[model samples]
Target: MNKIAIVYGSSTGATEAVAEKLQSALGDADLFNAESVNIDDLKPYDFLIFGASTTGIGDLQDDWEMLLPKMEKMDFSGKKVALFSLGDSASFSTSFAGAMYHLYKALKGKVEIVGSVSADGYNFDESDAIVDGHFVGLALDEDNEYNETDKRIAVWVENLKQYLN
Candidate 1:
């Protein structure tokens, strides 16, 4: 079985671009769009990578909002999930990458979620995405910190290798 699956919802293509980059960096993972994915299609994968973008006051990207309800019904027992989020921290400082929180909330106990990052090095004021002292997952602020996206992805992917392998 292909152990890794990347499921993402991107309305403006920015998140899709990152998802694509992640797939390339990881070297072995399948990509699926939230708009077209169903639970059966995801059943074979042991690890899932979710890419969600924050939009309109920290709302999940349109496609993800539609997918969450269905996800609640799927069996995540024993599976692993990671998340990557896109948000403009300068504009939504109060809720930067807040979409990651929603994703984490949905899958918290159901799956062995990995890839939490320290809350330091980011300039945002607050984010529900932070749980205990770290962001729920990889948080990318390409709008203001475009230069760091690649490095962040590389580091996050390196960390995830321990789990995926």
Candidate 2:
């Protein structure tokens, strides 16, 4: 069976819910909470979907801090990587999707950008769309005053399902 891993960090279970939904949608998936996961156990997976809930002024969740240094030092060549982030745009306007931005830059390898989502909004730039793959973003709740954020995510994820099949 093809192995896909969903490694995540969640504070209020919002990100966890998102991850579970994605995992169920994918089928044949392994879900791991970042806090209890060991790096060595990750070797069995062929693809990775990494998610983190933003904390402490646009930073990674507390449990994820220890793994950053380790992830920075390892190699992910020839691996498929998808990134998702949970954050409050209202609190940190400047760094709305900081965790995903930083992780994408740090991980070394042939990463196919799966995309990033936030509580603010996302871009559906025709130029940014990936033909053979998909880029997506989704909000955790309807708290976004403008209400445009969640709509974009739904659209993006619907587009993403095409590639998954």
- What overall lDDT goes with each candidate model? 0.90, 0.59
Scored by lDDT, model 2 comes in at: 0.59
lDDT of 1: 0.90
lDDT of 1 by residue, 1-165 (tens): 338999999988889899999999999889999999987999999899998999878778889999988988798876889988999999999989999888999888888889999877889998888999999999998789989999999999999988876
- lDDT per residue for candidate 2 within 1-165, as digits (tens), equals 447788888777877877877776666689999878888777877677787776665577666676666675455654567777666555555555455545555663445655443332333222111223332333333234335534454554554554343
**RMSD in Å for model 2:** 5.6
Off by over 4 Å in 1: none
Cα misplacement distance, residue 5 of candidate 2 (Å): 0.3
> Could you tell me which residue pairs clash in candidate 2?
none
Mark the regions of model 2 whose C-alpha exceeds 4 Å error after superposition. Answer: 73-75, 108-112, 116-165
lDDT of 2 at 40: 75
